[model samples]
Target: MGRNTRKRRTPLAAKALAASAALALGGGGLLWANFHASAHESHHDVAWGGNRTKASTAQVVTISCPDVGQKLTDVPARARTEVAGELAGLDRQITDAYRRLATTRDAQARDAGFVQNSILQPLQDRRAAVLDRIGLEVTRVGGTVPTGLSALATCTGSAADRTTGGGQDGGGQQQGGGQASTGGQQGGTGQQGGTGGQAGNGPAAADFVDITKVQPNVPAKPRRTRSASTGTFTTRCGVNTNKNHNTDNVIVAPGVANGAHHLHDYVGNQKINAFAGNDTFLQGGTSCQNRNDLSSYYWPVVRVQDGSQDFDQDADGGGKEGNVGRILTPVQAQIKYVGSPTGKVVAMPQFLRIITGDAKTTTNGLANANAHWSCTGFENKVQLTAQYPICPRGSKVVRTFAFQSCWDGRNTDSANHRTHVAFADAGGNCQNGFKAIPQLTMRLVYDTTPPTLRNGQVKNAYAVDGFPEQLHKPATDHDDFISITTGGLANRIAKCINRGQQCS
Candidate 1:
């Protein structure tokens, strides 16, 4: 976005099926049975037979399963790889089941039990099998497995209201009429055209709010103390001009292809993928203006629903997984590091990984949801989390991610990839046993047309790519960062902050 403004017109080749083929080739092996058991358990029965009418009356929009990754707070070093792979398998199972649900709408209309019996039940069985393997792997390595793993295997069908696309009023309260407006203005009532967005899976008419009508919700800034660092450092990283795009997640599911099940736009480090190791990052080239900053930054790509398909239209994490349309690159990508407001900050450990928001927020609830959506002009006045802002002409859309600023000081990574880092408190103080570190904040500005709502339908909608079952909801938007700054560079940043001087 800084220099390369032209969009890449040529579509890349579709991803090969070698990864899936490899999995299939091992189906007859013992590892396959351990990872995927054919035996089905009926302990957790779904209430579908008698709830047929209810299911038919209210459409099931997506599948919701407990996120096993979030539950695994600790794992022995030897078992981490195997457990992570099984967790990825759990996600794959859910994606496969969602595809089944989307294509069987006709069957669901005819039989109320179709979704439950054919989709959810089988999904539960597959998850249970994977969960058991995860438990066994941890226990086999002398690590105590987290309890209640079996209880998390069961999944249920989630309706639209319970999901991110659910209707909400101006104050962020759930409303039955699908209205989200402020100052007596009514939002879109375009229900005649059916649910909007791609594959009828997201960004409903209720998901948009006129930014002009939103009230000023920005809180007052915290008062800085005498010991405050007060300085900042900025890094110039182009807005993915080289088009480093992928569906793999090196942080969450290392060595597994297509683990994310959604496309990501990457900036900074050039040699990142699901199979990349720490050594790869240390030796890799970068896109940042400062070669010393070899860190990696990435998030899900935002796509415009303009009736076109990208190269991955038929591939696993693209259109085939319900993420369709033309991808939009941001116009400006600002990466900055700010000092602590309470005291001098410490240098972060090299290779430290931090994931700010929850990608499964729609189903996992709002405990860790931190998405902030607004327009460039209204940044100081309003920030919408669950709904996309319909900006006035001349104002561009913006997405901001304020990463965790406190570190546990013991590990660069955690089993869940979160416990090692945390956000500062309202008073800008780190919690007990945690130390303050320079906060990394990314601000991305997009030059795109604001979507419009007419007759209760959304037109020209843009949404963040997400998990197949996540429906590309705004709340599921998240960011990932890997701190690969050289030790000398990190020390210089800390010194600049402590001296109250801005540096690059």
Candidate 2:
């Protein structure tokens, strides 16, 4: 495969202006029984359709809106760049609106209808304009615009009452299990304080659960048959000791800086950013011990909210955006490629990009959520999806990501960045004209102290970086990958897996 040097012209000034205006605003658990509702489904009645008289007391915590990018499944190839830029603009609008809300709490307290009139409505208007541009771009490229694209323009405010509780629909309590306490106040003296995590947006007390209380939920592994490919190929990408960190997302918002709205800890490929083209990736250096594997692996940085500030404290994606704390470096980052259980696996196409989890799961729902949080010693016994696990003493935090293993065998990417790859079904068989490809799994371990609850306040709480409105919830945790493996190395990996041998 050859590197694609085709570059799309993006409006850098327009994106930068949107970001500047946003700079001003700034911004678990699977306890299946304790699962919270998606942002759209969890809005408090008083904040949504109820009388405005009650708005005086209702505290707007975050913003929730339909994810326009996810709905654009049929975008034409020529229009993708323009449409993506418009999608990113939507995010900037939300960020700016959230910042306005955060800084005007006094106004909200005085005027019952302040939030609805001053913040959300303006955001909706801004988003509507962007959505119109997106539609025009699609039509210009001879692609049919997705129906109801205009309906997603309206944004809503999520009140604190609905967002703080353990279960969104359960009204601050867990059913069947013990009461899900809305844990303590923010512990750190950092910029975060007031209602939620140190940053004041999320990781509420209700967002954590004791591992001892969670039942063993790990399902039994699928049985491998005689024809199953049982081998594994491990790639030794060292922990990001080099600290190759940034706040850019090339796949989603290429040419837009701070596109992720949160810091990312990167490993594997040394050259990664919003501006990196395919040629840059092909010529980039690698952190992997095997130079042939120049694949990139990255995820949002996890931070201890203990009154600390990273380099981005006042930067757009940092404290200004409500992401504040000391970033924790993972002690171990294990990257492995394993075979399919149903049949032999094929090599992944070069430059194939895969995002393994949903960064907006809090708002978009759990249909695509794949976050796996557990303690080092108790991973097999308990895995959490919505709440952060309170690991026992001496245990470390673990995050696991299993990438999609089925490919469409055509496009290397998709309009939504997801339709090109799909997860295998319950029987481990690829469906819908997709072919089985080597499965990529990552295990990241971190050495961190468990947060303590004292006097109804949490101390040393840790959280993953996220969009300001997403509130740093564990459920929003996600990972990104791009396969830049040389043909020789990819072939070797396939050979190792087909022969049932383990190789590096």
Candidate 3:
């Protein structure tokens, strides 16, 4: 199986508050390009990448475990204990293998080895053996095993033609592969990808592969999106599609590089990230829907890799031009306001400098996998493993982003630049103690067919225009802020998104 991996800006009142917050394929089968966010990636939404078919329809053979649910049948409880021990052991092996994926030396090759050696084969083999024993014991005790027990016993997928949305056959923990074999049905919005290539062994006893394993696929989840609009009127910060270089912060200043080798498309506050303080941002001009927003919103410079260099790709002349060679300009930057999820809007903490998408990635290692990527219709997306989905002919590839909206009600810049705030759920709800702030959501779009290369390659397309030594390319691509958007920004968000007003 493979693993892998939008936006807004705004203001408001009455309700103010909170906000917040990969890939790789291992092995020689596919030479996955290098495009992944780093540890900035966390254990949150794990919706994977790739096409996926639904549950299988193969008749599930049953072998229910008799009253075994009562802890341990007359059999020695050691069996359960042994299972637990095996799980711990297997987990450690996975952890160890994943650690090697991040190593700077031989990263890509390590990932492949980890996938084939550590995960793919062993997970289905060694792990399944332990589970197989459990199942064999059940029938010995006259246990009428569940139809899927044969597969579940090994924490594997069911080797059957599934019923799309019908439940799993073997009653194993869904997490243990969840019978995740994707079939040949093409998928996306209305398309359902195919099922897994059933294990070579006969159906009833084959090792059920995970949906993600057989095919680096993810089950479809609702694609959560919020567009900015009013009943009869809607506007974006009138596109300012130019490469802003002066504000590129090339002084080799603190926190920023000497000269960001990449470029960022600035929309809001005319002047920002020029190493300005909060007051400077509050005073800058804005192109927000109404031109009143003073809140500065900025991100990595989107560039068309046609060999056009704004500043030297290597300002310091280190001879290393972190240029990706042929990148494309982002079609548009959709900036909108995000408010509290619960009810009334919460106030945003001031001078918040939120950085999304890692900017320090290189072929060596991924500094952050949270550098999110997805298409127009995908709700549940993957991270890191460069599982970029190629948008169909007319569909669009979108980099949908959600900035941290929950403020600690204190400093904007944190020691690490992120912990100072949090984000809300799709429903706008925030966590405890965190005051909700009108968040910024930016959805950068690319309208062409995905290059056979991929969206990760797209990310690798251009670097953020900053200092050369800072090594802030696709990984260092991030954003900064200073709220000055007149109260109107927050009000509008509340009325439309929060209050159930369907405005796009």
Candidate 4:
């Protein structure tokens, strides 16, 4: 990652660097489905920011020509070769960063708090910034080069249409190249998934809608950051302020720590998965280092509690409603989703909305994380109080109903395992567009010894279902669970159903 702010591009290597720069800056790919150009308008009057003289639209066409027929036969071949070389160097740098992120999670684990907070995080930001900068530069040169190769120009229609960046297979070339260009009145917004072409004159069409700004993006982030303060303390559980249990915060009780220990079998490996730092969050905090405190990762094992009273005899006809009973813990659960019936598990879309909005260096040792939980995990099972307005109008939102699944070492075969505990909805119900679902799925599959029953007689159950176990028809199973704000509310429920009973 060398900073190339040096304005001096060796004259010979400028063109190729410019072209590659366009891809990096202009977002060369069609992923930005939001921005589109007008249809069939080829006026060639695009305002090239740096240069004033209008370049012929034909030059753009030649620039897009397949490698075999590239335009600019006139720009000395030497300059093109040099530009190509420099671009190769930049590509290598980008690839290196991705490799570090994808494979170095463990290495990052060894980093001290300051290194993780100050150095590592900034490196990630720099990578993203460089990507955007290069993309913008490439677009600038792309805009200019095509105009110079007018003879090879395959572009047609009004200027707006040309900007759309979509067209026929002229010169037998592939279509993806330029950055997204807008063709319409300056700043009017367009709805999601809609398409319209604005012409050079007449009424301008709506502006492009950015998908990144509107879709549900699930991030695997934790509620709290790790603390070097308590490198190796052994507390049973920890407690603090009751700031209304926010969806983003985590609260642990003393008994729950014992439950997690009992279920997982192994007491102290450090629940790194839950305590790791999350890039998605603006603020990171310290963890309770006192091992005796009782609020470590394993301390909060998901348990099956009773919640039968949550159901109504009329609406549910004596059947279980959304909130029936259990604390869904993340001991060994894996929640996923998908569209096609290809049998591949589809990843449920998730969004973490930070509640406090105020950035803090830490959660101050004891406080519920604040944030909104929206996803398909609880689809069909739980209900929503208000409709989620941000998503594209028709996107189907489904969720896996919440369940308390624990990760006991029953399946010693795997590093961890999970089981499901049923819960009922307190008051909400499902609506037309949205569905209720579970936020976690615990798994366990011990005994990897070579089995003689490969003949299909003995089914290979993951086997993590030890202390917490229950079964139901696919539709009636306890599907989802929600977070409570205060320890008092949770304690009240725990007392009402002392030994685990249906509240009714």
Candidate 5:
């Protein structure tokens, strides 16, 4: 059987409190795209991005010990001592591995420096190897060791102690029995204090894999585009609409009302009025419901490829121009007729909603792979707040924030509620739907002692025993029916047997 090499992330409830703290920090700038916040490009939520899937603990245990017994069963008695010594050495290595992992976790919390290659992964791998060797030796010796024997064993008896001894699996610890794997599930919340936290003059520890850098396919900075629609507007100035898209006919004037010489009724706060010929036009309120609307534009700093300037593709053009870009309001104005006939003018925001993405692609893009919803069901405008990563440790994990909307993909809402935004790839893939989307994952370094038998179990012989005294016990090395170790010896042996069968 081929070895499983993938690492995954498990969501813990601890993440929520951390997020809340960040939010209270008044734009900690770690969650989304805001003027005052840090860019959280590394805290990506999609799987394959920072959200890499984690493997079950049991599977990792099996992987750590791939060859459980063959190495020592046939050795001479003189070499048996050598084997025992080697097994003891393995036990110590496993212990050290776990201790180092705990230390690493503490180091990450303090923002101390450490690399995945030099200090973290090697220790984990070594722990796995040592546990494997011990598991094999224990299996060869026979069934689970008696309570008395356990006292003499080389590894920690407690599961957590065994795990920290080697730090082998990605997800927390493996469960005792059969259960579904949780490798690719979205992370719930993480613990408070962020990163690994502070460690006193205690044991050394290691940090988990920064999920941000896990996938090569996911981009560090995604491409975005922004476009605006021409809309009608009404202000204290006179109402005017040049059929031509040119701005030549628009005029700005004081909102203050003059004397009866230029009589006019002020609409709302508007004091200026438009006149047709010599007569003053009786103007009413203006609503630009179906009229042209004013627009705004914003371009972002793009993450370059190979240090070269390229096309800025990620700009989602949906906001108003300049000052109006952040917040949009409905426009109202008055329109004067050419005939001087008494009439009212109403102006409303021509564009009540924003449609994002490249016009060419929005009409047609690759199978909805990169389009994320800034808004919800109502198409309400989304106010992007902050975006940045949790940690920049080698992996490129990123998280983002915005005032959640009603799932309308809009910005206008009568009733205030919690905001919910959907995340997806830059290509337009959404987190919604069936297929598991790549997000973030942590490369956890943990140790666990392999399983050992409980005390007081009845022992049995290897040879057949159904018959009477005529049935003879087989004189062989395969006499034991169980084993005792800090790793998964039976699983490894089974794997090796299966592989041998395949080759045969």
Candidate 6:
């Protein structure tokens, strides 16, 4: 929805946009997953991007309604005040079903019937028409829409920790059998009937070790500039130059386009995408310096184009210069990590994907403040624009990425992804209730010069692989990841981050 920057406060942490209210999503929907935090949650069994639902012709989500009739007793406050007339009645029915299902201990017994009937069925039947009405109503209301409005469209369940802007909750059972973040380090729990009732635990000297936060955070982040080292407990993993990709546990449908948009640059376990299972690569091989490291990492390929330049989307027919041709592999990659207070490392969840940068250069197109762009020798940096500053005589251009290190010690991903993970402090320390993992730091360096030949025979840069029907431009630059890293590797990194070892 917006730029894929790390959340900045400490719920694991992200700066509060407005102190904790319901979250706002792409098309004006709000999501709220009021779940308590927990600790036993190591990795998630769901897809990489969280429990998000898409309108699929090939895949149908069948939900059964409660035995209760299609009437309602109480209406949501937002619906009462914000929703208009006939639509208001429909909104109340939807909310009432959710309310019943929310408190029903045996909700799962219906075969996810409640969700299929209440949320998905009507949505599927009237996709275009319903969305149109929702959009119209959202505009009439000053700021709020019906609270679960977007969730119906997405089917990501009732909301877990907030992740993206859409506010889709990942708490309830989504896609049949997947775990949502019930409780995290702060001692919370999920609301689902399956594992929601299970008691959480503290660190055991046995298999599950506690990863504490680093204090005084070694090196503080420099103001207005990127810090190479916060002197934190981050370590670098290995990167392989192999050509392989696997799609299993992800949420991909045979012909759906929502899961992945283009060709991906994969590191570590080869099999990954919207359809790869979490266990697919658990014992899989790696292309990193350490063969033991199995964390899967992926992102859209960066095509170095003989640009007509970016940021000129509507201005100069420069759209053709955005991205095209074959997606190229990174010359080399480096895996960086950050640690917890006690400097213990835990297993990263599956399908943890983050998209940064805009795909187009239109002023009206969505862009993020966190999308950083700069040249090696030039001190100035840019964000969310297709425009790139020319580098000096021999310097290279770069895209520097810093993923969140601190986790809530529970959920693998929040609705927006960033909520369960937050940015490291200036001191590189996590927030009060959060634990630290290996924060991801990446740099995709482009040093090649554009071709000088003609016949219109000039060189062109390509974005990640797609259907060739569209171009993947600079504005759309982003990254994807899968946690296939072995458990042993995590512990060793914990040692390094704890002892402050700069292990490669």
Question: For residue 451, what is the lDDT in candidate 5?
Answer: 12
lDDT of 2 by residue, 1-504 (tens): 011121111223322321221001111011101112233343321111011111122244545677777678788999987777777777777778767766676677668888779987887788788888989999998999878989987765655443332112111111111122222222111112224565556565445667766766565666777789899999998989888989888888878788888899888899999899788898888999999999999999998887767888999888977788889999999999998888998888889988766777656543445677889888777666666778888899998888888999998888878778877765778887999889998999999889765433456778899887776767678889988987589888988998999999
RMSD of each: 12.5, 12.4, 19.0, 27.4, 33.7, 20.8
List TM-scores for all candidates, in order.
0.83, 0.83, 0.46, 0.17, 0.16, 0.47
Deviating ranges (above 4 Å) for candidate 6: 1-126, 129-241, 245-258, 305-323, 339-369, 378-386, 425-432, 450-475
Candidate 1, 1-504: lDDT as tens digits: 011111111111101111011111000100000011113322211111011111112244555566677667778878887887888887788777766765665667668887779987887788888888988999998988778978887776655333333212223211111111131132333122333565556655556778888777666666899999899999898999678999998888888899888999998888889999898898778899999999999999998886767888999889888788888999999999998888999998899998877676555533455678899888887776667888999999999888889999988888877778877766788889999999998999998888876655577788999876555557567899999976498888888988899898
Q: All candidates' lDDT scores?
A: 0.69, 0.69, 0.36, 0.20, 0.19, 0.35
Better of 2 and 5 by lDDT: 2
Candidate 3 per-residue lDDT over residues 325-383, each given as its tens digit: 32345777777664443544554544555655333322212222233444565424321
lDDT of 2 at 82: 76
- How does model 3 fare in lDDT? 0.36
Cα error, candidate 5, residue 51 (Å): 31
Following a full C-alpha superposition, what root-mean-square deviation does model 1 have from the true structure?
Answer: 12.5
lDDT of 6 at 103: 39
User: Each candidate: how many clashes?
Assistant: 5, 13, 116, 100, 138, 75
Ranking by lDDT: 1, 2, 3, 6, 4, 5
lDDT of 5 at 126: 58
What TM-score does structure 5 among the candidates reach?
0.16
